[model samples]
Target: MGTNICVTFFAFLCLIALSNAQTQFLRWCVISEAEQKKCQDLKKVAASMYANRVPSYEVIPLIECVLGKDVYNCMEKIQDNDADIMALDTGQAYFGGRYYNMMPFLAEKYSPGGAGTGTGDGMNYYAVIVAKRGSQFNVFQLQDKRACFPGVGTAAGWLYPIGEFVKKNGQTNIMQVTECNAIVKTATNFFKSMCLPGALTSFYNPFGNNPARICELCSGFLEKKCSTDDPFAGYDGAFKCMSEDAGDVAFLRHDTVAQMAMNSSYMPDNYELLCPNGMRVPVTDYMTCNYGSIPANTVMTSSLKTKPEVDVYKNFLLKAAQWFGPSGQYRNQFDMFSSQPWGYFNRRNLLFTDSTQTLVDVGEKNTYYSWVDNDFYQIMEYHNACPLITARLCVISKQEKKKCEKMMMAFNAKDLRPSLDCIKGKGTDDCMKLISKGDADMVMLDPGDVYLAGKKYGLEPFVVEDYGNMNASVHVVAVARKRDHYMTLFNLKKKRACLPGIGRGDGWIIPMNIFIETEQFIPQHCTLFENLGQLFIHSCIPGAMDKDYNPNQKPVSLCEGCAAGGFRKCQRTSEDQYFSSSGAFRCLTEKGGDIAFVKHLTVRGNTDGRRQSYWARNRRSDDYELMCKDGRRTHIDDWENCHLGQIPASAMVTAKYKSEQDRTIFWQLLNYGQQFFSSDIEGDFHLFDSGTWYNDLIFSDDAVRLMRLDKSMQDYRNYLGQDFINKVENLHKYTCVPVKPSKKSSSSHTSISLLLLAAIFILQLVV
Candidate 1:
C-alpha cells in the first residue's frame, strides 16, 4: 500500500513538470511571412504595455499563432482552436464567418486623406479600375479583355469590380451568393485571360482544372510563385501587372496608384479611371470616378470560443488597440492597418480598428447581409453592385403611427431612396428612450427635448427643421397688454404670468432660464419649487401637472387659470388657451393671465386684424405689446431687439449608431417629400399637419426645409449656452427624483392622522 501511494505521487510530480515545460502563449494567427514578423513586434510592445501600470493594456498573454500558410489555413487553425484571432479584409471576414464558423469582433477605422479624425462611415475605401491615360477602352468595351486582380476574394480589388458587373445585370438584394462561384464563372467567361492570385486554390474558383487560360496572364514562375503566396500579390502586384502591360485593365483599391506614385517609381499622370457610367476620369479623381466602397477590414475569431470567451478576446483586442493606436505614444512602433510606408503610417494595424471607439457585435451570422443599409445589401445580394445606400427609418409616435405609415406608403409609392417604418412609443421621452435602447430610429424634437434627448439619452441631431429664414433660431419674447401695470421683467415677478408649458423652450424652460440667469429666482434657495411658486404668486404655466414642474401642487396655482380637461389647458396643441405661441398670447387677451411668454411674432401674427383663429379674429394689433429688457414696452413689430436669446429650431434626432448612408437617405426622402408636396399647396397629400388631421406628426407646419445640425451633443450644450444647459440638467435631475413619500414616512404620517381623528372624536363626545 505504501509503495503504491509513492508511485502515484511520483506520477503526479512528473505530470506537473510536463505541464510547466509546455509554454502556453496567447496565439495570434498570421497569414503571411510579413504578418508573422509583425506578430514579433506586437509581442514586444504588448510585453512593455503589460508591464507598465499607468495606462494598462494588459489582458491576454502575447504569442504568435502562425501555423497557416494563407488566410484560408489561418482561419482553419482558428476553427480548430490552434490559433486565437486575425484581421482580414471585410470580404474575407465574411467568407470566414460564413463557411468556417468565425465571428467578427472589431472593424478597422481609417482616416481618408490623412485627416486628423476619421468618421464611422469612412471605414471603407473606394475600388477603382485603373488603365493607361491614353487607353481608348471604356467599361462597355471590356469584353474578352485581359484583366489583373489583386486577389481572389479581396474586396476593393476583386469583389468590387465583379459586384459592379452584377449590379449592371441586376440580380438579387440578398448581399453575397455562397462562395462567389456564380460571379467567378461569369468573370472567367467574360475575360479572355486574367491574373487573379489565389483564385486557382480559392473556394470560389471556377476554372479549377483549366490551368493554361487561368494562369496565362500570371507573372510568377512554377507552382511556388505568381499567386497569393508571392510578396507582390495585393495592390503592389496589381500595379506590377499594370506597369508590365500584362493586362489592359487592373482592378485596385482607391488611392493605391496615387500612393505608389508618391514613390517616384510610378507616375500618377499615366493612369485614368474607367467608370461604370462609361466616362473616364483622371486617376486623382478616384473619389468620383471609382466603384463604390466596400466594407472595412474586420477582426474575426473562430466559433471555438464561447460567448464569454469571445467577449474577453474582444476586450483584450480593444485594450491592445488603445495602447498601440494613433492616440498612444507607441504608434511609431505599432499600427492597426497595412498603410505603412505609404506616407500614412509606419506600423500596420495588426489586431484593431484605426479609430472606432469599440467593436460592434455583428452577431453570430457575420454575413454580408448583416451590414447596414438595405440598398447596399440588395445591390450586393442581387447584382453585386456597390452603390451608396440608405437605412430604414424608424419613426417614434403612437398617435402618429398611422401618419407615419401613410408617409411610408407615400415614400414607397414614389420609390424614394430610403424607406420609412413606424415604431410606437407612449410619448416623446419614451420615443427617445426607445432610440437609446436601439428599438426606434429617429423623431422630430423641440429645442428643450433636443437638449434632453441629446445630453440625457445619448441621441444626436441629424436634421434641424428650417422655417424659410436662413437663421434657424427664433426669438423668445414676453408679451402683455399695453394697459397692464407690468412695465419691466422685474415688475412681473409676483404678478400672475402666463407661459406656454413647463418643458417647452419658448414657454417655460427658456423663460425660467432667463429668470435664473438674471437673479430673479435662485434654484439653490428653493425647496422643491416653493421659491418659484412663491415668486410667481399664482401664475399659469400650462402642462405643469407633475410635482416636479410645480411642487406646490396643493395650491392649485398653474392649473387655476387652465381651461377644463376637454377644452385644453397648457398643452402644446391648439385646443389649449395657454398652450403654444398663439395660445399663450390668447391667455393674456382672455384675462387668464397678465403676461405671456411666447415667440416674438406670436402676438403680431395673432393680432392686427390679420388673424383668422376664432379667439384672435377681433383682436387689434395695438392691444398687445412686447416687454423690453431695459424696463421699456414696445409694439409687437419691434420685438426683434427686445427678446430673450435665440432658440434653435426643432430638430430630428436619431441614435448615434445609425449609419451615415441611412441618415443621408432619410434626409433625401424627407426633403423630397417636403419639396414635392409644398409645390402643390392645394394637393390632397401634404407633408405637414393641418387643422384637424396629422397634428404635430413628425414636424410642425411652420417648418419649411430640414437642415442638417453640424453640432454634436456637447456642441449643442455650447450652442444652447452652458449655464442654461446646466440649469436644465439640474432641473431634470431634481424632477426625476421620486417626490412621493417613502413607505415608512407614509406609515408614520398615517398613524398620526389616525390618532388625531380619534382625539377629535373624543373631544366631540366630551363637548
Candidate 2:
C-alpha cells in the first residue's frame, strides 16, 4: 500500500510538470521578415535574462516567434492556436475582438502623460487633420480638395476622420450609392484626388469599380500603387503625400507631425491642425483641434484563454517591456521599441510601433469595445456606412409611429444601414402627400390607396408583404353557401349581396369592375347607386348609405341586410356587425345575404373554429364555396383559380423620384429586421405581430416576410397590372360624378356631410 501511494504521487507530479511545460511559453506573431527577425532576437534575449537570473525574469515565460503573412493573417494564427499574441491598432483590435473573439491584454503608451496616465491602464491618442499653415479650407470646405490617408481601416487614417466627416456633413453625395465600401465612394466624390492606401484592393473595393482618382495621388509604380507597399502608406507616408504637394490635407495621429518633422526638413510649425468646428490651430494645439481621441494599439490573444492563463501572458509581456524598454536595464541588448536595427528603417513600425514609449496593462478595459472611446467605437460599428443616410417612414397614427420607433431601434441594434426615422402623418392621404413632397421616404398602403397614390401623388411600390404566395397577392372571391347552387353569377340580378365597404379593393371596386367586364351590369348616365339598387333587392355594403359616400342618393335597400343596430346601422366600423372582410363573411352566413365579397383568407381565418366570436362559433371553411367568374361554384380552397379578380398585395410605397439604390436599401433594412425580429423568433419585438389591440400597425399582421419587387415592377401601374389599372380607371370613368346639393337642402346637407366625414375618418383609423 505504501509503495502504491508513492507511485501515485510521482505520477501526479509528472502530470503537473507537463502542464507547466505546455503553458510556460507564448508564441508571438510577426507579420514581415524583419519583424520575425526582431521577434527571434527578443526571444533569445529573454532566454538569456532567465539564464542570468535577472531579478524578476524568472517569473516570465519562454518567448517563441511565429511568422504570419499580414496583420489579418496574424489574427487568424492567434485565433487558430498557431500563435499566442500580436499587436493591433484600435481598428484592427476591434475587428479581432468582434470577428475572432480576441481580447486586448496590453496597450502601447506613446508618452509619459498620455491618456489613462494616473491609473496606468488604457492607452489613448488623438487623430488630427493637418494642412499647411495657411490653407483656404476648413472642415466644411473640404469638398473638391485633395486628401491623404495612412491606410484603409486604420483608426487615425480612415475611421476617425471619415466618421467625423460623415457626422458633420451627412455623407454628402454618397447617400444614393449602394456599395460594399460606401466610405470609399464618399471620399472619392468629396475630394478631387486622394492617396488612400489599399483603396483599390478587392477587400476595400470588392466590385473593382472605385474611382481611379482615389489612387491618383499614390507614388508607387505599377501594381503597388494604393497598396500597403505604396511609397505613401502610413502616418509618415501620408505626411509625405501632403508635404510633397500631392495632397492638400493629411489625416494622421497627433504625434505624427512632430515625429516626422524631426526626420525631414519640414518644421512642425509649418503645419496646422484643422478643428472639427472649422478652426485652424498650431500643431501643438492638437488636444483642442483634433478629430477624436482614439484608443492605443494593443497586444491581443484568444478569448478562449482562462483568466489565469491570460495573467501569465500578461506578466510575461510586462517583464519584457520592463527589461527591454527604452529606460530598462537591458536596453542595449534588445531595444523593444526600436526597428532600425532590423534593417527595415523604411518600414519603421515593424513588430511594434516605433513611437511606443512603454507597454501598460489594459486592466479592466481589456475588451475592445470597453478600451476604445465610446464615440470612436460607435463610429467603427457603422464603418461600412452603406450610404449612411436616414430613411424616414411615414406613419398614419401614433400607435404606428411608436411601433416604427421600436422597429428603428431593433434595426439599429443589428447594425442595419441607412438608419430609420419615423414621421407621423394625419392619415394615409397625408402620408402619401408627405412622401410625394420628400418629407418622408416610405409608407405602407393597400392596393386601393396604391392606385390613388400612383395616379395622383406619383408614388411607386418597391416592396410587398409576402403572405405565403409568389406575388404576395390575395384573390378577391365572391363566397356563398356550398348548398346554394341556384345563386350563380348569371342569375344574380335580384340577389342580396354583402361587401366590406364602398371603395375597398376586395369588396366594392373588384366585384363592381368584374360585373361590368362580364357584361352582367351596364352603366346608364353614371347613376351607379340607382343601377345597383335596381339590380339587387337588398345589400349589406357597409358605408354605401353613408352621406359621405352617396352625397345625392340614400338607397334604403343597400343597408337592409346589414346586421348592426340603431346608431351603428350601415357604418364602416367594427361596431357595425357587418363591416370588414370577416364581417362580410358573417353577413352571408348569418344575415340574409346571398354572396359575400372578401379576400381568400377571410374564410380560413374566421371559420373552422379558428375564431371564437359568437357569430363565427361553429363555422367551417368547407361550408363555403366561391362563385367563379364563369358562373361556376367551387370549394373555397380553389380561390387561386376560381376567383372574381386578383388584387395586388399591400406594398411599401415611396416617391417615384427615389433612386433604385434607395429602394434596395429600404428592402434590405426590412429584410434584416424580419430575420432578427420575425414572429418565429422569441424576441421582445415581432416584426409581423401588431399586438392584441391593432390589426395592422406598420405592416400586415399576416406578413411572413417583405419581398423586394423587381425593378421592372417598381411602378404602381406595372405592379398592379394593366388589367387591374384599366378596371379601376373604368370604374371611376363610368360611375363617379361630381354632385351639387340643391339649394333647398344645402345647409342641412353640409352639416350632415361634415358629421359623416368625421365618422368615416374615425372608421379609417381602424387601419
Candidate 3:
C-alpha cells in the first residue's frame, strides 16, 4: 500500500509540472459543452490568423473564456496585458443593451495609455430591479432612492444604469452611489434565486403563475385593469401584496420585452397632416414621432483603427456571445433576450435603456432630453474604463469603424471629414439624396462636428426649401440631422433684405418671444417668400387642409380675410364693426382684386363691367362687381358668398349663371409700390416664417432708398430697428437692380457676318 501511494504522488507532481509550463494553451472560460465546441472552432481560426494585420491597417482579434472549473485559472494567463487595442461590444442593437452609450462615455473619459485618451470598449444594459412577486413601489417613486445592479465593471449591468440615475438627479452635481451586489450574496438574492434553475421560476419569471409576485416587488401592486402602462404592464393587478415580499424589478433591462414595451408604445404618431384646400383624407404614418427622433446610427471607440479592424472586432464580439448557450439560452435564462430584441438591435442601435425612463422622469429640469443625451455624455465622460471610441455621430459602422483608426495611425494623415454621419427621413426620398450632395441645413446637427468636418474638407451645406413641419419651419431650409453643420457658425453672407412683395406674407410674424426660447431649436427660418396675398388665399381655400385646421368659425362676410388662425374680428370701434369691428379702416378690394393670379381667363362675351381682372363669365351679372383675372379685368358675381347669394351645394354656381364658369373667387388688395406696406399685404407684423424679423420686411434697402425710408428709416426706427436689418439695408440700397433679362443689344453686323460665312461654306462644299 505504501509503495502504491508513493507512485501515485509522483505521477500527480509530474502532471502539475506539465500544467505550469505549457505555452500553447488559451485561457478559455466557456461554461457549456456547446459553447466549448464553439471556442474550439474559434481556436483553429485564431491559429490560422493569429495577430493577423490587414494591409493598410494593423489589428488583432483577442478572445478568451472563463471556465467555472477553476475561477482564477482563466485570468491567470493573459497572453497580452494590454499591448494593442480592444473593443468589447459589437455596437449592434442586438447587444446595444450592453454596449453603445456607456462605451462612448467610458472611452471619452479614460484617455488610456498607448491608446491615447478615450480608448475602450462599450456596454449596454437595462436598469433592472429583480424584485419578489409583490412589492409596493412604482418606478417614479424610486427616484433618488437606493437601487441594486448586477455589477459595475461591464457597461451593460452597471455604468449605464448609474449614469441614468445621475441624469435623473438633473445635474451630476450630487448623485448618490448605487448599491449593487451579487444576487447569490445579498438580501436581494431572493429575486435572483426565483429566476434561477431552482423553483420552477419566481413570481416574476414573466412566465410564472402569479406575475403579480414579481410586479409587486418592483412596482408595488398590479391593478387588474390596465391603469395606463407597464414595461409589459397591464391595466392593474388582481390585488396588492406586502413590500419585503417584493422580489426585484429589472428597471433598465436588456433587449427584454419588458424593457422595450413602454418606449415603443409611449408615443403615437408625429405629424399633423392636411390635404390641399382642406380636403378630407386619411392620414396615418404622417409623422410618427416628435420631441423624439431615431437613435444614433453608429459609433466607434479606441477599439479598432481601420474599417477591417472594426469588422474583425465586431466578429469577435459575436464570438464572445457564443459562450452563452444555443445563441439564446443562458445559465440564467431570464437574461436571454438581453441580447436579441429589435430595439436593442436596430441599425442605429441604442446605447442605454434605463435612460429612457430617466428622460421622462426628469422632465421638470430637462425637458425634451432623450436617452441619447446621457448615452453620449457617458461615452464622453468615461473616456474608457477599458477601450472606447470617438464617433462624430452617435451611430457607427464596423466597416468604416477602422477608418478612424487609420487616421490616428498616420501622424501626417489628415481627415477632411468627421468620423460620423446622420440623416433624417422627412417628406420624400429625393430629399434624402440631398444629404449626400450636402444640400439641406439641419438645425439638429451637432455644431461641433459641422465645424470639424467643414474645416477639414472644402464642403458646405446649403438650404433647400419646399417642405418642413409648418408649425416650426416657415422660412429657410433645414438639412439632414446627420449632415455636417459647416455653415451655422461661419456667418452666411446675409442675403440682401428682400422687400415684402405680393409674395411676402403679413410682413413677418411679430417677434415670437412666447414660444421660441425653450429648447436648442434650429433656425427654422425661410427665405423663399410665400406671397402675402397668397398666404390669405392659401389659408382660406375652402375644403383645403380643412381637416388640419379644425377651425372654429361661424363664417361671416368680411370680404377681407378668413376668420380662423387668430384672425378674429378686430374691434376698431363700436360703430364700425363687422363682427363688432373696431378698426377705422375697412378692408376693400381694389379694381384689381379677385384676379385669377394662378390662371388666365379669356373674354368670352362679357357685357358686364367687362375690362380686366375678371374671368369665367359664369353666374356673373351685368350689374355685379368685377375683379382681375391674372391682372386682366373680368366680370363676376359678388366675391363674398353674402353678395353672390350662396349658390346651392349641389349646383355649380358658374354653370347656373353662365355654362362656362369655373371661376373660383380668391381675393387680394394690390400693394405694388407701397413702402413698408402692400395693399395686397395686410398687417405690420414681422415675418417669422422666413426669419426676416427686422431684416427684410417693411423695408428692403432699395425700397427704403426709393421710398427714401433710409432717411425715413429713423422715423420707423421704433418699428424697424437696426440689428440684422443693416445687412439688408446695405445690400439692397446699394445693390444693383438685377440686370435686365432682355437680350443683349442685338448685333445686325454679327447677323450679316453669319450669312457671309454660310455663303462661303456653301461655295467650299461645291468646290
Candidate 4:
C-alpha cells in the first residue's frame, strides 16, 4: 500500500506539471504543421497552435498555447492558421456563437468553449443580406424626424442596417455639402469608421448561385439577378463607386436571429423567413427551428476610454456590418488593416497620425515601389516615399561638381556652363564649395534654375542653306528647331513668371519648394517671346538736319504731319483689320515704313556726362522722354535712349567686327540675328528684337515663311530671308547679346575672370 501511494503521487506530479505548462502559456495561438515543425526544429517551446477553437478566439486556450514560452513574434504563425481554417469554411464552427454555446459542454462538464459541440454547422458564421437594393437611402438632407427601426430579429436582421443609417446621418451635423466627390468621400469615411466587416465581391454578378469574384463594373441596384454576396472578402476596394454598383444598398450585420429585428439605428434588417426558393412565408416564420442561435464570434475587445475604437478594431460584428454598408465598399476593403505587421500609412506616406495609432519607422527613402500598384507590405517594408528620392538640383550641382538645375517652372534639365572658377583649369573644380564649407543647406536648386541657366548656355550657331521656296523667293539661311531647345526657351519664360513647368516637353518641371501652380502649355506658348528685332529706325531726321530743326528741338513738319502726339490711329499690321496694344503687335504692313504712322521720338535725362539720342539736324537733343518740342511723349510709342554712347550704323561693321568681343556679339546677330546697322549714320534709332511700329514682330505669315525655309528648324540662320535679314536694325537688343564663351563658367575662380575682363577694358580706355 505504501509503494502504490508513492507511485500515485509521482504520476500526480507529472499531471500538475503539464497543466501548469499549458495554463501559463503566453498570448497568440497559432496552428500550422509547417510552422509547428519550424518551431520544434527551432527548439521553440513557447509557440503552439490550439485546436480547441476554430477562430482561435478562445482566449484562455490561446493563452495556454504559448504559456511560459520565451519567443518574440507569433502573429504570422497565427494569421496563416486563420487563412487555413477560413479556407476550409469551418471558421464559423469556431468563431460563431454556437461555438460559444458549446464551449461549456466541450468536456461534457461545462467545458470552456471547445469543438465538442456537434450541433452547429456554421450557419451563423457571418449572416448577411442579399437584396438588389439594400436598405436604399442616399442620406438626404437632415430633417427633424426620429428614425424608425423595426424591432425584433428577422432572418436578415437590423442592428448593422440601423447602425449604418445613423452613421450616415452623423455627418449632417458637421457641415452642409453637396457634390459627387464630397458625397463619395463622406461615404467612404463613414464606411471605414462605422461599417462592419463582411464580403460583397461580385455581388452584382451572379454565378453558380453565388459570385465568381468581386465586380468592378457593369453592376446596378434593384435587380435580383444582379446582386449576390461576398464582395468584402478581400482588401481590394479599387472598385468603390465603380459605375454605381452599390449606389442604393445599406448592408447590415447582426449578432443573432433574435437581435436581427430589434429596432435601433444600429440593428440588422430581418424580413419574414423564407419558405422555399427564397419565397416569404409569414406563417412559417414561427413554425420550424429555422432561426437558429448565431455562434458567438471569437473576438477580443479592450476598453477604449477616451475614444471609441474604429469599426475595423471592433469584434466580428463590425466586420459583418462592413459588407452591408451603403457603398458595400467595406467588405473586401476592410481586411484587418490594423493587424498588419507594419502600421498603416496614408497618401502622405507618413506613419501614424498620432501616438495613439502606434507605429515605428523602419526603412525610409531607400524603400520605394518600382511601380504605382506595388504591394502594401512592400511599401511598409520601406515607408512610401511620396516626396520621393529625386535629384535635388542644388545638391546635384554641388555633388557632381557641375551646375545642375531643372528649369524652375519645368522639369527640363539645365545646361551647365563650363567652369571659369576652376583654379589652374582643374577638371570640373569643386563647384559646391559653399555646401562643403557648411554655408548652405544643400537643398535642390531653384526650379527656375533651368530657365536662368539659359544665361549660361552658349549661343552655338549652325550653318545651312536652301530649305525651300517662300513668296516666290529661294532663300539661303540657317534654321533650327530642336523641340527641346524651343521648349527650354519657353520654360525659361514660365520660370521667369515663377510658374510651375508648362506642358510642352516630354516631362514637366516643378520647383523644389512644392509649389504646383502651373500654367499649362504656358511653357510652350511662351516661345512666342523669341528674339525677332527692330525693322526700322523711326528717329530719322525728317528731310536732313537744318537750322530750323535743331538737335535740341522737335521736327515741326515731321511732328505735325506724322511724328506728332500720342493718340494716332494705326493698324497692328496692314493685314490686321484693327489695332492692338503696342505690346505684342506684329507689324507686317508697308515693310520698313510702318514707323512712319507717327513720329517716334526719344529722350535722355543725361544723368551721366554722356547722354545718347536719335535725331536729324531738325530735332531737339535735350529731350529725355519721347516728348515733342511741345513737351509731350509722342504716339509713335516705340522709342528708347541709348544708355551707352551712341554709334550710327556699322560703317565700322567690319571695323567693329574686328575684335573677338565684337565678333562674338556681332556674329550672334549675323548668324541667327534680326538686328543690323544702317548704311546711313544719321538714321540711328534702335529697335527691339520684335514688336511695335519701330520694332519687327514676326507675323504668322513671316514665321510660316521662315519655317518653310527650315524643314526642321535645326538651323535658324538658314531660315531668315534677305527681307528678314536686311530689315534688322542696330538698335535691336538681339543685335548685341554677349556670347557666353564656352570655355568659361562661374564655377571657375571668380576673381580671375573679373581681372581678365577688366584688363581688356583698361587697355581700351587707355588707348
* lDDT by candidate, in order shown: 0.63, 0.76, 0.23, 0.21
Candidate 3 per-residue lDDT, tens place, 132-166, comes to 22334443334323333221122333344333333
TM-score, model 2 to reference: 0.59
The candidate that wins on TM-score is: 2
Model 2 weakest lDDT span, ten residues long: 113-122
For model 1 the local lDDT of residue 477 reads 93
Please list all clashing residue pairs in model 2, or write none if there are none. none
Decide which is better by TM-score, 1 or 4: 1
Residue-level lDDT tens digits of model 1 in 1-767: 99889766754553443343322356788754555666766765555455443233333444555647667778888888888888777666766876577877766666644322232356666778988889888987887888888777777777666766655345332223221214555577677888877766645432244345655677666763546555346666677777778888899877567556643568877888899778998876776776676666777777667766666666666676676665756667766443455232222233433234334445553544464234444434533322333333444434356666777776554444444677766556677777766566777777877776766566677777666676666788988888885567876676777786677787767787777666676666345355567677676666676443545454457666765476354444433545555666777888877788987766766676644456777888788788877778887888777887668777787776566755655565676566545523555556654333223356655555677655453245644666556656655543443323223322444577799999999999999
- List ranges where model 3 is wrong by over 4 Å: 1-38, 41-133, 140-147, 153-156, 168-247, 257-374, 378-767
Give the lowest summed-lDDT range of ten residues in model 4: 346-355
**1-767 per-residue lDDT for model 2 (tens digits):** 99889766754554443343433668998765566778877876666565444343234466788887556777888889988899887877887887677999998977645421211232567888999988788877888989999887788888888876655244442222334235688778878899998677544554477899999999987865876657787777898899899999999888787767555587988888888877899888777787777878899999998887788888777888889887989898888987655566455566677778788888899898788877876676455567537889998666778788999988776556778899998666678777877789999887876887786677899999887877768789899898888788777788899987676678777988877777667876667787778778999887787664576655788888988789677765444667666678888988569889988877887788755566777898888899888878998888888988888888999887778778877776776667678887877788876554443567765567888898898887889988777777666655564323223222343577799999999999976
